[model samples]
Target: MAWLADAVVALVALLHVYILVLEMFLWDRPAGLRAFGQSLDAARASKVLAANQGLYNGFLAAGLLWGLWLGPAGFGVKVFFLACVAVAGLYGAATAARKILFVQTVPAAIGLALLFGARA
Candidate 1:
C-alpha cells in the first residue's frame, strides 16, 4: 500500500513537470495553444501569465519530489501538494476547462487517498 501511494505520488509529480513545460515554455506553441484552445497570437499575449502559472506547477513538482525523498515523513507533504492540485483542478474545471477535473483533480485525489490511507 505504501508502494502504491509512493508510485501515485511519483506519477503526479511527473505530470506536474510536464504541465510546467507546457505552461512555461510551450504556452504559445502549437501543443500548448491547442490544449488551451487559444490562437497562437492569444497564447503569445498571455505567455507571461502562463509562465507564472507554470512556476507554481514547478513548485508543486518540487514539493512532491521532496516528499518522495523523505520517506514516511513525506506523507503530510504529499497530501498537502495533492490537495493543492485538487483545488487547482476544481477551479480550472469551474472556470477554465472541465477536462481539468478528470485529468488533474481526479488523479491527485486518488493519490491523496492512497497516501493518507497507507499503512505506516
Candidate 2:
C-alpha cells in the first residue's frame, strides 16, 4: 500500500513535469499544438500565456516532490496538490476545454484516493 501511494505520487509529479515542458517550451510548437488541438497560429499567439500556465504546473510538481520527500507527511501534500489539480481541471473544463476534466482531474482524484486509503 505504501509503495502504491508512493508510486502514484511519483507518477503524478512526473506528469506535472511533462506538462511543464509541454506548456512552457512546446506550446507554440507542432507537438504542443497538436496535443492541445490548436492551430499553429493560435499556439504562437498564446505562447506567453502557456508559459505562465506551465509555471503553475511546475509549482504543483515541486509541491508533490516536496511531499514525496517528506514520506508520511506526503499524504497531505499529495491531497493538497491533487485538489489544486482538480480545481484547475474543473475550471478548464468549464471554460477552456472539456478534456481537462478527464485527463487532469480524474487521475488526480484517483491518486488522492489511493494515497488516502493507503496504510500509513
Highest-TM-score candidate: 1
* Cα error of candidate 2 at position 45, Å: 1.0
Clashing pairs for model 2 are: none
For residues 28-96, what per-residue lDDT tens digits would candidate 2 score against the true structure? Answer: 788898888999988988899999999999999899888889998677887898889888889989998
Cα lDDT, all candidates: 0.92, 0.87
Best by lDDT: 1
Worst 10-residue lDDT window, candidate 1: 111-120
Runs of candidate 2 with Cα error greater than 4 angstroms are none
Question: What value of lDDT does candidate 2 attain over all alpha carbons?
Answer: 0.87
lDDT, residue 82, model 2: 82
| TM-score on alpha carbons, each prediction | 0.95, 0.93
